[model samples]
Target: MAVLTERPAAPVRRRDRGARTLVNRFLGYAVLVFFALVFLYPFVIQLGNSLKTQEGAAANPLSPFPDPLTFAGFERIFAGTNFPLWLGNSLLVTVLVTLGRVFFDSLAGYALARLRFRGRAGLFAAVIAVMAVPGVVLLIPKFLVLNQLGIYNSYAGLIVPLIADAAGVFIMKQFFESIPVSVEEAARIDGASVFRTFWSVVLPMARPALITLTILSFQGSWNEFPHSLVSVQDPHLFTLPRGLADLVSGSLGKGTQYPLKLGAALLATIPVAVLFMIFQRYFVRGANEGADKG
Candidate 1:
């Protein structure tokens, strides 16, 4: 019989390395928790102050609770201004814009990624250049375009321009590139057209990427203020940001009503915050998608 000698010493190196890794992971989590609180505490303060009265808020700006909690702020928000209307308009615009972007962006992205069409490179280059243009600088230029198109001061002006974004297209294109070409080839072998393949097979596989794009579009259009400011002028046509700006700028007329202001801001934040909480994982993936594409 061959003598089976025990391996003298399975090197204990792996065991030592794993212990070090566990310790490092623990420390990393501790650091992350610390920073999370640092960033999140202000929102906590805002929520608390929003419940206080004007005097209470002014007296204790940093307090997270009011001595005598009041709904005066909320009542005022409902009664004193057109808060409900603004909220409704914001919702309508955001939903339409998000849906439009998800469709248009993915369509364009698929074409760029899979179609060997004329001017494909040039079109993508133009998209990159468009994305480089600063949004603030486009205020006057966008206004001019809207006026020229006869959509200014209308809902069309507000919602149409936001439907297609270069960055969103680029994001989708990069994601499509990360997928293997064999999948598309297989679909083609089955005699499926490009759109049919993309809609049936590819898009379902791209659920994670789609969710990320959806969340980004929702947050971006919901929080957009400058675009709304320049797009429409009529109070009745105003989105939440436009109405909110009008509310703060002498429209409310007398005192500095911090509670009411904070209340409106807090309410404005809730939808996106809820969406962020629910789709937190998708958001994380989306943020990292760019790195993966690179």
Candidate 2:
């Protein structure tokens, strides 16, 4: 009698569970949307303020839209300053760094994750240890190294050290470890070389992780100021952040060139902004991947 009654109870329990799931999903989305706006509002203000004139921008720093749109700021960026040159430099550095991180970091990561060489564990441990080293503390050491290599004031110094990061390697290694071994095993059984298998088989499956690292590399190199500060003293070598810092620190003359400064920042931010907008799903996937791997 109890068994027969319990059969009907299954449907009732499932219906209640489905209702609870629906409510949870709705609440989750609501929280996400709210926080997204909160985090993103500053960029929105930057975009709007950049379009305002010098007076307008200074007067209304908090406004979301320019009262009267002015191209004066952008005009100054192009006409009065070597904005295009800095933009080009930033793009060049970002591309090379991102590519290097994606390739080298993944190779190191996969080796650390899968290969069973002597001292592999020690090497992986070293990479994690390196990641814990604070960036600011490395400032003096990096400068000394760059000077010793005679690449201190060159583009190479700015781009090379940033190419392969410890964090990227660690992230990739974690993701690689979480992946099923059967996939790599199948490729190996077909007589593929390790590099060939990794290049063709494993990396394809690591698309989410790769994109995440690429995006991080791009953002990091793009906003990099301290490295640029120590790497080169030449105005010609100034990336956007370096140039912007110069502008803010009275190099752009006495009063605030608010509009021009904001305009430059706006342009500088667009690439990462567009990337974040389009690859948002991958970002979420990457976050979840790290959580699972850890």
Candidate 3:
């Protein structure tokens, strides 16, 4: 019998495979870098324009370098516009909405997850249906309801309607279900009431989900514009988004006012960016956990 030997061509095949992988990886990285620059280019322009003089910003709107840097835009933001008032309203609405959503959504989620009740499944299905409904579709109904309730054009309208969202409830319920029922059983055996079990035992263990909810709620409320448009026509009650809209619609004197507009938008984005950065890991982990449970 002839002794069989591994083909020397095997090494050449291996080298070919290695070369293909290297090429693919380089191409992948190049693609990623290209998209990253594309996505980030507008933000770079925004920042640069915000620092430029009005004339320079109007002239070089697409440029990422300011010909003559100035703080006049930001200064005008505080001194000229109603930015301070808008900022305060935004902060207040965001805080209240975030807190209310966290508390109410968690409670609703726990009830849905652990409680036995008539029509529980139906209620959850309804929540799912609500989630499916486009938010804009509800705008007219929401406006009517707020008007009927005599809360329109008031902080109550702005804050109360957003306190609990179907998505938050869905997220919390999924996360709660992921916790073994045995844990709640243990708490029950120790004579913990339903509220006690949920509040102390379950809620404490639900830090990740809560953080995720809080961040979402804060961001949503902070960036809310349509609701504000329908809820409050009063300039004093205007949030950052509504105020920005007004600014864009020529609330300030004529000309693009690119520097001032971009500056205000930049400032509006900072809070959400900071919050996301701080809780990014927690948010991702919570979202993954909730998704897995679902």
Q: Which candidate number maximizes TM-score?
A: 3
Whole-model alpha-carbon lDDT for candidate 3: 0.89
**What shift in Å separates residue 147 of candidate 3 from its native position after superposition?**
1.1
* Model 3, span 77-166: residue lDDT tens: 999899999999999999999999999999999999989999999999998878777778788999999999999999999899999989
TM-score of 3: 0.91
Top-down TM-score ranking: 3, 1, 2
Off by over 4 Å in 3: 1-9, 253-255, 282-294
Residue 24 local lDDT, model 3: 99
All candidates: TM-score: 0.85, 0.82, 0.91
Which candidate achieves the best lDDT against the true structure? 3
Higher-scoring candidate on TM-score, 1 or 2: 1
Task: Answer with 2 or 3, whichever has the higher lDDT.
Answer: 3
Residue-level lDDT tens digits of model 2 in 1-294:
767757756888878989999999999999999999899888888888888988888898899789899888899999999889899899999999999999999999999999989999889888878877888888889999999999999999989999998888988998899899998899999999999999999999998889889877888889898899888888898999998888788578757788888788888888877988998887676567557545
- TM-score, prediction 2: 0.82
Per-residue lDDT for 162 in model 3?
A: 95
